[model samples]
Target: MEEKAKSFEELKPMLRPTGVEPGIMKVDPEKCTSCGLCIQNCPFKCLEMDEDEHPKMKSGCVCISCSNCIVACPVDALSIERVYTVKGGFFDTETPAVKMPMPPKDADGTPAEWNEVERVVLERRSVRHYKKKPVPEPLLTRVLEAGRFAPSGGNHQPWKFTVVTDPEFIAELEATLHGFWSGVYPVFNNDETVMNMVGVVETGVFDPRTQYGIRCIALKELPVYLGAPVIVYMGAHTKLNNPALTIGICGQNMNIVANSLGLGACWTNFGAVPLNAMPELKQRLGFGEEWTVVTALVLGYPKFKQFGMVARHYRPVTWFRPGTKTPQTEK
Candidate 1:
């Protein structure tokens, strides 16, 4: 009986959705590139590429609103928004004029110049390997506190944050992340290899592999994650309006806060992929049935290397319609 009970416990579900609403992450199919970036970054595995070659939310309890999809989108097209509502509201609502606060005007009654935010966005690098040093607790607390104050829809304030500093837990999470990479490697970028009579077949179709794969290699090769010594896991309210947007705002806020504190941080959805695949991992991290993983940012000191922004390569900007001054037919 004891052994049977233990087996059942091992097989038990780690979480269950409240069903008050069918939780989902809405992906704009028209803007989708089938890049799989969102799918790879989603901590809850709530997103997967569909037959239409668009992202689809596959799990009811998988959305954690880490906002990785929004940042990873090559085109400023993808956004993370709520899938369901506990209380039905207007589906098509305009921005309420009443909610607007009139800024102090110029002497001519024109609005004043835009005020800059306290925080500035940094040129963030996707840091894979760390130096295996621990981040200071006070600094980590300050980062979380910055997230705690992020804006929400109608002040829903439904976000939850859990920080894991335990080395064993971090190691376990890393193992799960590696497991995810091992499984998804073949699917991403067409890396499937078939074995024949030889020891093993080799397929190098996907060049450079994934950033995470490269990071795994760096962890072995160089002191990357640069011994920052800490990993911060962010969890957000999955049911809020534009949950992805809110989480993005909050996550960026945390990043800026960290930057201001003289600490370096890198945001990635690598940790989330495995957490989504295995529920027990979520439970172990202290998330109940109702919550989801939004994103994970590895924090640490840098290897004294400065990675600045690169020149942005982009398609030409096109306008919807040509000026009326010129006819449709061009010279």
Candidate 2:
């Protein structure tokens, strides 16, 4: 067998940090309302209310600077102060060269025209039907690169992509999930008592469409992965701040890049739900206990061409202005 060339990690020198410091949580007492939203939203649960009902970090707790507390503060009372710095490592101080040129602009420095990126974003769709043609390795690599460049909280970049192209393995995984769902479909379908016992109805989460989709998946009518030739499993470190959110951003980048490459891509939670439940299967797939299957994307050539901007449902938006006492609502 031919030996592979040096990998990217192999070619780069390892960087060892000399020291590390976590971010400090800061609270504005005047702006704080003792709502406890910041404390409730902190992933680490390292925050507590002081005697005056002000939020403060608990002793022996370190902030990873995920910024969840800041975002959850409706009155903007909380913030994280501190920068991540490293020294005494084989780190490059010089700025790297820009690989891509800037977007074209008009004389006034505004966008010149409706660009390709905008067009691609507008025309992108969740493709369900796919052709049998396999996605090329180079195109798949580009999609992974797009995901790799996605921004993460505190620049942690805590994500791993597993590309599966093996037809037999994909089929086996699909069949296993289908079997599990098939066994539970009867309880999920006919037995309202069981569904109620599971708190599905009490939570006001019962939806006919969701049940129908589940039925299709259980019956193997929906083909959990849509029979795509390539599946990208995205896993992330759960300890990091907002791992799901980071994975979502990374998946979006991959989907957009897949669309640009004339490939159909669909984000699927079907596989993730089942795979996460199966610890042995997850371990076999090389995911450690610390990492979780955040989501997956199926990629393939579309059976039919889909283009042009699609109409989307409008959502209510509220805008707050400096001069306005009440915020303006757009419906």
Candidate 3:
């Protein structure tokens, strides 16, 4: 048997921070024919070749270990080794990169046409006001297909979308949602514990009790889905791994697809809140045994023209650095 070369760990360098450590990318010389795809796709420009044409990291170079080079390597010559203080690991094919179409590009290599999917995502908004118009059956089916195609944990594909368009049913949904808020309003009024937990952001002008009261009263005046002709009830089994998240993921895909089809859509947790007290709703909404409602989508034409970009902020992000020691306590 041919003996293998000693690995990076054989160098025994002092490891980086406790929780986050450096990930080294290794290339097998025999497997690589120096095609140079890895060199082209390296985002950090960490990979280079020697006189023998074997890809290696430049002297004193550090890899952020994003694994772009590994994913772009057609021959699988590049391997990423995530080094931890106690252990090292690799990612599955799913974790490496996703397969998707190339975006339309300009002559200058800048994206020429803003991608339709990208535009839909950036422009999507939670449309509260909708015209009393129905979504066509064909369009609705396309949106459901988007949900059906969403990725799931372990390929369980555990998502069922029940679409309700009947006026009487929407009325019942409105009543149940109102009842939930009405019931909660009293609790917030009476229970200090519940009040503290509510922590309702005084978003515009009302206190927690006031907001709940306002919502309950508004629900009584408005039909469910705000007169939108479609209500999509997203349901999933509770036994699967983080099933609620799969339902949410399906819903996100559905909503974006809806927007692309010229339909306005928004998801609501309040729609499912009533199910806690109204078990009969489970049967009416087609939530079978072992299935629970996760979220809901209301779809229709926008009542008012929505144009212009809205300012938004993202949550804080921390980038881990290589060769730096960061002390963090395990929870």
Candidate 4:
């Protein structure tokens, strides 16, 4: 009976949209280089390339509007529509390379300064490989200042940061991180294998947790901090709701600021998994008891720079087009 129950648990259906798994996506064959990126990005295994070097929906598969295929196309060949249809091929909608829309200017023609901000945002990539050089003190301080300037609810600003640069401490941290995950790995997956990861991802049954398990396995081979010289911990311990959002805003500021200064930054919250589970680690870091380690980031010079933009999944969004008479409720 126990084995039967466990088997049933794995067979459960995930509650996403029902009609079509992926909304109608068209691929311009002329533009497609058959890069197979869309196939690589599909979490559900719903896309495959036809013999003629064009992407096609896998046989008898339901489509979801995840937009993974459309966004992964480097050549702007794939597109998606708001409606759900499967008849058209590639000429249905234009799926250009994603870009942040330019915001309108005021009467004085003062353009939004956010163009540069957008460039930094879009260009920012989480770098894992770093050169064996220490980030300059001035640049590091500037990144922290950017983090400190992040806004908080009611202007409370109930956040604190811990910057770790001591080489001995970082080495110990790496060892502790490795030990913690190694022991806890079996709890998530008794049978750790790449095939199991793919199976769990396809079911969408373990959609979020599955990713965590996969990441744990990846971290075992790749150092969680990726040999960076500096780490910044964004933390708070107020008796309020989770400060995850505030810490994220702060960390993002640090990331963009770091990137702008030609330094690479990668967010590594997994470091906290060990710290929170073991109180001694937190104490070692000089943080008070129960201090929620909201985010952890590493900063250093990247070993290799990523030149071109990689396509990302375009999230389905609803835009409100303006009408002559605005709704009274809106104002």
lDDT of 1: 0.54
**Candidate 3 C-alpha lDDT tens digits along 1-331:** 9776444353112111112233467899989989886675543455788889988886543344545566556677987654212223221112222223346688899877766677787667666567777778999999999999999989988787789888787887777676666665444444333433322423221222233334444445323355677889888887777888888888999998898888888676667645644677787777767787877899988765442233232323455567767744322
Q: What TM value does model 2 have?
A: 0.62
lDDT of 4 by residue, 1-331 (tens): 4543234234322311122323456778889999887775543455787989788776654445455555556777876643333233322233323333345476698875546766777667676667888887899899999988998776666677888988888988888887766655544444333234334433542433333433443456457666889999777766655577877887888899999898988877667645766777787776677577776999998766532244443435545557745433321
TM-score of 1: 0.50
- Point out the worst 10-residue segment of candidate 1 by lDDT: 91-100
Ranking by lDDT: 2, 4, 3, 1
Ordered by TM-score, highest first, the candidates read 2, 4, 3, 1
Model 3, total clashes: 0
| Predictions in order: lDDT | 0.54, 0.71, 0.63, 0.64
In the predicted model 4, the residue pairs found to clash are: 20-63, 21-63, 21-64, 22-63, 22-64
Count of steric clashes across candidates, in order: 16, 0, 0, 5
Model 3 alpha-carbon miss at residue 136, Å: 0.8
Question: RMSD to the native, candidate 1?
Answer: 17.3
TM-score per model over all chains = 0.50, 0.62, 0.57, 0.62
Across 1-331, the per-residue lDDT of candidate 2 in tens digits comes to 9876544344223211224343578899999999887676553455899999999987755454555566556787876555222233333232222122235688899877657898788767677667889899999999999999999989989899888899999998888878877876677544333433242223212323344456667766567787889889999988888988999999999999999999988888777656777999888787889989988999999766444342232444689989888989864
* Clash list (residue pairs), candidate 2: none
Stretch of 10 with least lDDT, candidate 4: 12-21
In model 3, which regions exceed 4 Å deviation?
Answer: 1-113, 192-224, 320-331
